[model samples]
Target: MHWQRILVGGTKGAGKAIADRFLRGGGTVIITARSAPEEETESHFVRADVSTSEGTTKVIPEMLDLFKGVDIIVHNVGGSSAPSGGFITVTDERWQQAINENLFPAVRLDRGLLPSTIERGSGVIIHVSSIQRTLPLYHSTLAYAAVKAALTNYSKALSNEVSPKEVRVVTVSPGFRETAAATRMFER
Candidate 1:
């Protein structure tokens, strides 16, 4: 609960809220995104798209150097950028993008940071999945839902492997919330 070091994988929406909460609780918070947040904040900002390998590379070393490791790592980056009209409408590129955004970031971050956590013998990894994983809206979120399901599975497997080492991996599947991204999705 009283984490001394925290890394949030995104700096907007739920990710931003999580980082802010930790910062208010006096934790040293580090947040990453493809772009900086529109407003200023106290958390250490790392501008990197963690969905990609390059982005994870850019973030991991900096965080390891600065904090040695984090006590809590929240994988809070995910979304669907594909168009509407169900499975046939979603292109291969869009599916890959969905996997990159929804599944791979958490995998990469855990791969990068979990070693330190295991070494220290304690840490928590939180994956932000989605309710769409179970109740998929085929019209637009097919790829998103499928990838989130994969994320949930991955989180469970990771938890089994790491729990013995004193690391906790958790998956939180939240329903829709009216964030800026969700608002845009609805408007479209």
Candidate 2:
């Protein structure tokens, strides 16, 4: 499946790995993140804060320009900056941050890109979710888990809506991996 042009939100950790795989398979990979990846990859990095609408707005033109348009989208950006306390300690601000980081990027990107994909009548969307969505660790990742739950449900609904249009939407729920964020969480 050579998608030719692919867009991946969050070009770090698992996102980078996925982009690398696509690049190795001869696909053009464009990756977005607040900062560059730790190391160089075959992917073209688009530095944008995907946690905000402004950032996503910034990305759309660049992405469209990069490859004319994309055929595949991987929504992989997610994390929490809130203090790792129980539910009482998790503030409203933190909850919103989780939604911004984990959920809205996908929503906004789909809103922006899916039109072209639908017009082409062919594309794939992979929403990277968390196992925590079902098996939560409330001590630290409650907000992330809850937002991912919403994302997973939304992805499923999107699959239902878009599959009929010939755009395949899939959600990939991965278990814990030792990314830098996870290392930080463990250190905390």
Candidate 3:
């Protein structure tokens, strides 16, 4: 039997890239998005917001049933909201949304799924964080930076908890990729 993996991301573009790469290497990949994809392959898509607990809870069970639990989890979901103006113009709701979007999904997914990874004692989990999390692009991204910082620290601490038991938890903090979001940010 082949090992299965899951890629959790809000937008499927980057996650789909990762999944296709993995699928080429022989592992089955399950994609989780707000709307499931119609593609027929090992790339199984499930619709779940994930930024909310309800969404994450609703999706994890279906995944467990499909693949008998994932051997790897790539937490590729993250993004920022708010206008081009500085911090002064931003509202509390956007700040809250940033935290919920960039951080909570990983937390919820790991909380619900890590137990199985621990039980198997052999899985690698990667969280796609952001360098703005540390560098702080300022203005609109300040809150995003702060939340991702919290997420990085949380991931590090969680690694300590699970690493000793054989699960590898690591985070990849990316700067601006030339994706649609970055292009728009540059244009603004």
Question: Cα lDDT for residue 52, model 1?
Answer: 90
TM-score for each model: 0.95, 0.93, 0.91
The lDDT, on a scale of 0 to 1, for candidate 1 is 0.85
Question: Residue pairs in steric clash, candidate 2?
Answer: none
Tens digits of per-residue lDDT, candidate 1, 1-188, equal 54545555557788778877887888678888888877888888988988899999998899889888888888888888788888899899999999999889888888998999898879889898999989998998899999999999999999999999999999898998989889876664
Weakest lDDT window of 10 consecutive positions for candidate 2: 1-10
Which residue pairs of candidate 1 clash?
A: none
lDDT per residue as tens, model 3, 31-121: 7877665466567778789889898998789877766688899999877766767787668998889888988999989988888888876
Q: What are the per-model numbers of colliding residue pairs?
A: 0, 0, 0
Tens-place lDDT per residue, model 2, 1-188, is: 54645555546677777777777788677878888877768777888887899999988888776666688898888887767787988888989999999999999989988888898879989999989899988998889899999999999999999899999999999988989888887776
Error of 3 at 22 (Å): 1.0
lDDT-wise, the better of 1 and 3 is: 1
TM-score, candidate number 1: 0.95
